[model samples]
Target: MSQNAAAATAGPVSPDDVAGLRAAVTGPVLDPADAAYAAECATYNLAQPTAPAVVVGATSAEDVAHAVTFATRHGLAVAVKNAGHQVVPSVGESSLLITTTRLTGVEVDESARTLRVGAGVRWHEALAAAAKAGLAPLAGSTPGVGVVGYTLGGGLSPLLGRAHGYAADHVRWIEVVTADGVIRTVTPDDEPELFWALLGGKGNFGVVTRIEFTAVELTAFYGGGLWFPGEDMAEVLEVWRTWAPALPETASTSFAVQRLPQDDALPAPLRGAFVLHVRFSHLGDAAEAEELLAPLRAAGTPVLDSIAPRPVPDIGAIHVDPVDPLPYVETGFGLREFSVETLAALVEAVGPGSDCPLVTVEVRALGGALDREPGTPNAVPSRGLPYVTFAFGVAAPPDLPFMDEHLAKYAAALSPWTDPRNVVNFIAPDEAVSEAEVRRLYGAERYHRLAAAKRRWDPDNVFRRNHNIRPSSAPAGD
Candidate 1:
């Protein structure tokens, strides 16, 4: 090993080492002792906190490359954080953290209907920019989520996902700083293999600086949520299971049983109550949207119905995801089919009177364009899976007796219908994903291919702080 590498392994990073990092990059380098360190390290899911030896507030692709090069020379792990929505607990004090929040930039090509967004740019920013051009990017439910990270995880958007597929599939180019300290502009034509790997590969290979992706020529959508009492969860789910599959490509739908806290911010009906929220987004006329949703509306009376024609910029309002960061435990699994048995199991697990401590249990219907393969193949796995079940529990100080037990029980109950695989995006922050689970998530063939690519792009495994795809020749380490 080099002298720097030996020194890095010998003991904790000294102030001089941090000073060297600061000198190497034209960005702020923060040590743990710095006053701003804690705020810079704060993540969206507070449950997976990280304490890196140094945090680099990256302002440009060059800064990212400098940080990666520094980490490589010092034999330190490198981790990238934008919005810090998806957490990987492996990034600890031994690693070098690069925060991309300073790299917020957005450029739109109206004629091509494309958007180029910086790593730190959130969905709402991109949406607003695209909306000016009468276009819409495939953004997920939450507007606060970082565009780059979300796209890397095969972003499942609310509005046009069933019609357009994942946001990763729409990507045209990616600007990344690889482990070798090289700034690469990845596309199908330029470094095709790396391009494919980076799409759904997460941050294992490099820190992405910017992404250029296709946007839809859409200005508005008729979509929103309908809230029913907790008592009607089973019936609502049954109706949704049937209704969602029958819906056309222009529509995407999901249902969630939300046990909302009694907060003043919440609507009067939803505050302090267990309610079932049915979210629907249609890319067609308002009248058609209403007509298509008639059956679900007829099934029961909703205490709150906000379904109406809305501008595309306001799409995030449909899901009503929390805007502020909070401590939460999330777990999810893909299902081959939402069978009658599976529906029953779901109701038993979190429906009324179950006393489930989970804040919300959601079932999203997947099919249509999401099932279809993209023109250019990428790393996104589990395309044909029909449904996904996700549950969120608040990470409160007073431990609930049923937290782990209920989660396991819920998974076991749906095991028969559940696919052994997982959608990478839905993987929880603190979830322990084993090698076997990785193989199950990505098929054996794809997993091996991803590993081969990892070997080529990040041979030393410097960027291992993610849903890692370990190089075939390298020993897997945390």
Candidate 2:
């Protein structure tokens, strides 16, 4: 049947369609009744449920191409899932989801100082592989996040970001299966516009199978976190707000106000209590790092201090973000500056005395290398923004009804300092982001270019499961 005819039928997918896909691809095909269907469709963000009509476990680029071609031929939308860390709902009930968990491969070249990683490869695997060669790829705080998805959203690494900018800027090339079902190698020289779109465009244009990027040398850095009593939140944040903007590019830092569950699983100092965590990472010697951090340390007595020299693989320790997947709601906004008033507003909303249900609220300092443009232009937007304020609340079944209002109250409190533009990587799972919001994420010019590229590469809008960029010729509502 032709794609148009198949789409017009609009009934449940038949067994014949699944069988056809299974025959065309080397990987396994899963339907609702399949034994592995649930596991294959599980996502890291439990709040965002995925109920795809079919799931394809893609093992290679050829597998990805086959799946894309099959989906197109069957008139089904395609959604790609790697580590399932994406907060946005990429896969839906009627979609054909391609899971890249089996594409776990990594190659590190010490001589070239570059890492080639498959779509399934997470930061931990890449970090371990690069560590063996005395190098490290720019990765996020959570090591479990898939490298491709994170980098495509303009990965803001916990460390080295102030020195090296975003991970996307370091990308050398990518191998993607576009909507046309062709396996193409994209780079600055090979499909310049597509390459630019892929850099920070998320999964709008195509499905990436593998990515290669320049890795940095030096396997160790001086970094970690300092924990203060909840009563000292004001003092800690004050010191951080003043000290952060003055630091050199070698230093990157963020401060979080966290209310931990009173459970034995947490450390004694942090168990069942609210505390202020001052996380810092410096790409320098211990003495230099200490000198730069002394003022913040002297602000108040710390209950726990873990700052010291550490190997590159231990970079995740800086933020100490939760490694395991759980249900939560996250939201954030960019800030042009963080003044005393902004800090006060934050304290009033989610601070020590506030009856906030949020697990953590943080503001990361942005600037330094992040403000500078890359050698090659990419789609990463709002680089000039100076700070990003984010907060997350652990979702309990009872709280689901009020979670949106609860989170919105806190976000509104910070509105005076918050900018409409936010980092694409930090968009929350439940946020009802619209096309105008997406256009603002990328500036007007970059958005237009991205739309033009989408028109050229995916005019059919087959890859509409992400922070979508509609084709130029499409109607506004379409």
Tens digits of per-residue lDDT, candidate 1, 1-478, equal: 4343343455567788778888878888998789999988888766667898888999999999989887876667899888746565677877889999889889999999999999999988999999999999999998888999999988998788899999999999999999889999999998999999898888878999999999999999999999999899788778888888999999989988888989999889999988999999999998999899998998788999999889998988789888777777678999998878888888887887786888888889889988888998898886898888888777653453356566777777788898866668898755535666677788889888888898888876788787777876555654
- In model 2, the runs with Cα more than 4 Å from the true position are 1-12, 88-90, 475-478
Q: Give the alpha-carbon lDDT of every model.
A: 0.84, 0.85
Q: Cα lDDT of model 1 overall?
A: 0.84
TM-score to true structure, per model: 0.96, 0.96
- In candidate 1, the residue pairs with backbone N, CA or C atoms under 3 Å apart (3 or more residues apart, or in different chains) clash, namely none
Highest lDDT against the true fold, candidate: 2
What is the C-alpha local distance difference test score of candidate 2? 0.85
User: In model 2, where is the ten-residue run with the lowest total lDDT?
Assistant: 1-10
Cα lDDT tens digits for candidate 2, 82-161: 88476437566558899998998999989999999999999999999999999989999888889999999899987978
User: What lDDT is reached at residue 166 by model 1?
Assistant: 91
